[model samples]
Target: MELSNLTGFLVHRTDVKMTNFFTKILKQYEVTPEQWGILLVLDTERATSQKELAEAIDRDQTTVVRMIYSLEKKEIVRRIQNEADKRSHNLFLSDKGMSLKTKLMPIVKAAHDHVTKYLSDDEIQQLHEILSKLYATVKDE
Candidate 1:
């Protein structure tokens, strides 16, 4: 059987393509897709726990932790002790992170808009719903 005939192969290829596109867009910002994802989420929330960050980005805890650490070293994100749970740390965007997010948001939106430019609003919604369903199917297993 041809590898290209497999749905998983197509999905993976598309994922790689999108990631590469975003990598180029984010190159100067020095943030990867994962880092940007977490930064975006942190920007929305006043403070979020590491576990929450992992869940929000649909990533494993270890991966999220490592990315957060990198962001921390760069002074983009900092972990403050959770007041309620001293053992846990809540994530927050530093002034630097917020500033970067502001700059990155427009470029990110433009890049995404460019990718979906040919799709109608309805088509975009339908595609998103279909992808979410596919993700749930495998993720729930």
Candidate 2:
């Protein structure tokens, strides 16, 4: 196989492994990977509409809505009607969600560190850039 093909195969394998590891770790917090993604995004962006979250996370609206409902039921998130746009509801992390984010951030960081341990700092930087470029390419399609 060509180098590119080999890299693609490794990427796929690594993604599966990473997902499994993350799922196990996040389970302790009673969160799935999808829920974690939403939490992380809300942590950084603060109050945002579900539509915005869906676009930012590159997930379908239906999937996002389902995740939102689950998180809301867990008291990890709350939906507030948009004052200006009655048709839209903005999502915000609840006190519980904020607490969870604070508690779980170190675990997330450690997982990331473990996964990238084999790469040198420069290689890690390059890898990020390459991945960003790849994402942009596909996002434009």
Candidate 3:
């Protein structure tokens, strides 16, 4: 069987292409896909510890810490000393980050639409379900 026919290869190839696509779009906004993931999490979850943010984004704590530092440097994210845990901090998007998110929501939606233009609603739903199932099956291992 050809390498392209392998499930792993196809998934990875698609991921790389999608990341590249997003990278180009996000570059103008001064955000990387990884940082964008953190922003989205903080936006929805509100104040959360770095550990929680890492878990929510399926990334390691150290990596999340580094990302948070970068976002902080960009003035897009702020770390407040956690009242309950002085050693840790809760993450929040700054005013600038909120404005950026507001601007990005539409473009991100358009990007999603562009990528899935060829897929029907039902196909898209099925794809989501399949990917979620696969992710769940392997995520704990």
Q: Specify the poorest-scoring 10-residue window by lDDT in model 2.
A: 1-10
- Winner on TM-score (2 vs 3): 3
Q: Give every collision pair in model 3.
A: none
lDDT of 2 by residue, 12-127 (tens): 88789989999998997899988888888895346799989999888999999999999999999999999999999989999899999999999999988998999999999999
Q: Which pairs clash inside model 2?
A: none
Q: Write the per-residue lDDT of candidate 1 for residues 1-141, one digit (tens) a residue.
A: 999998889989989999999998998889998889988899635889889888999999989888989999999998999888898998899999999999999999999999999999999999999889889899967
Candidate 1 local accuracy as lDDT? 0.91
lDDT of 1 at 30: 95
Tell me the number of clashing residue pairs for each predicted model: 0, 0, 0
Q: Could you give the candidate ranking by TM-score, starting with the highest?
A: 3, 1, 2
| Angstrom error at residue 100, model 2 | 0.4
Model 3: lDDT equals 0.89
Candidate 2, TM-score vs. the true structure?
A: 0.89
Candidate 2: C-alpha RMSD after superposition: 2.2
